[model samples]
Target: MSDAQRICLGAIAGAFGVKGELRLKSFTSEPEDIAAYGPLESEDGALSFEITLTGQSGKGALIARLSGVNTKEQADALRGVRLYADRGRLPALPDDEFYHADLIGLEVFDTGGAPLGRVKAVLNHGAGDLLEIHAPGMTASVLMPFTREAVPTVDLTSGRIVADPPEGLF
Candidate 1:
């Protein structure tokens, strides 16, 4: 899919209750806002769903109901399905904030314009997001902390990032 078309907001964990309720794992900064983007579509664009937040559940997930999902078995069948919203439906971010989708695939470069790698993914595990760069000439990908000190500049227009990685992290 083209990067401009969609942004993955979350996944359907499974059916929450018997009455079509789904366990939604939201990837938004405000978990509850996942429903505001309107109907979410499957990756293949074959299926689409409108989310209605019923309430909050364990692990900060939301118990939601999707249109056309009425049975526990039906919801169970959607487990592990990633949900995406149209790019235009999402709100614009502040200057310093960026959607992970926008960062993925951006090229990475050192201060001297040396190619480092391409961004494979952006990860956040309690700490801020880290840029997982798929550097060539390396056995494994490099995990560079996505901090201002490390990633000094991100030029989305150029589709590249200028990084001042920590010593020996290149």
Candidate 2:
């Protein structure tokens, strides 16, 4: 299936125990709700798994059993596999909220209407999200804080973002 047809919902952290249970890192606000998205597909959509939440690990990660996985080796093999749900199953966001998937390809512009570039990715290294812009002439991508002060406007319909970067950031 096409990536545009699905939205990432969670990931397999690795095997959680000697049994087939796997550790899950949920991308949802309500971590447990990851199971509500129905069957999840692998990043490439080459495989699908139906998850049944068993409980939580002592470290707070979610414990789950995936359909057809019955051994530690089977669960361990799924480590680092990203899970995606059909976009149709997701709820619409409020005006101020956006899915990182929707922002990936939007063009970015400065206050003066000059083009910065398109958003290559939205990264969150534990300190809020950053907009990674792949500018036309730059040797490296620029990372801009995705804060209200830095990114004042995001027009999803127009597929454009207006950024008022911190001084000298651009």
User: For model 1, how does the per-residue alpha-carbon lDDT over 74-126 read when each residue is reduced to its tens digit?
Assistant: 99999999999888888888877888999999999999999999999998877
Residue runs of model 2 more than 4 Å from their true location after superposition: 58-60
The alpha-carbon RMSD values of the candidates against the true structure, listed in the order shown, are: 1.5, 1.5
Local distance difference test, each candidate: 0.92, 0.91
TM-score of 2: 0.92
**What clash count does candidate 1 reach?**
0
State each candidate's clash count.
0, 0
Candidate 2 per-residue C-alpha lDDT over 1-170 given as tens digits, one digit per residue, 9 for 90 to 100: 67777888889999988899999988876889999988999988788999999999887789999998899999999999999999899988899888889899999999899999999998877788999999999989999999999999999889999999899877
How do the predictions measure up, each by TM-score?
A: 0.92, 0.92
Following a full C-alpha superposition, what root-mean-square deviation does model 1 have from the true structure?
A: 1.5
Give the local distance difference test score of model 1. Answer: 0.92
Candidate 1 segments whose C-alpha is farther than 4 A from its true place: none
Model 2: lDDT to the true structure = 0.91
Q: Model 1 — which ten-residue stretch has the worst lDDT?
A: 1-10
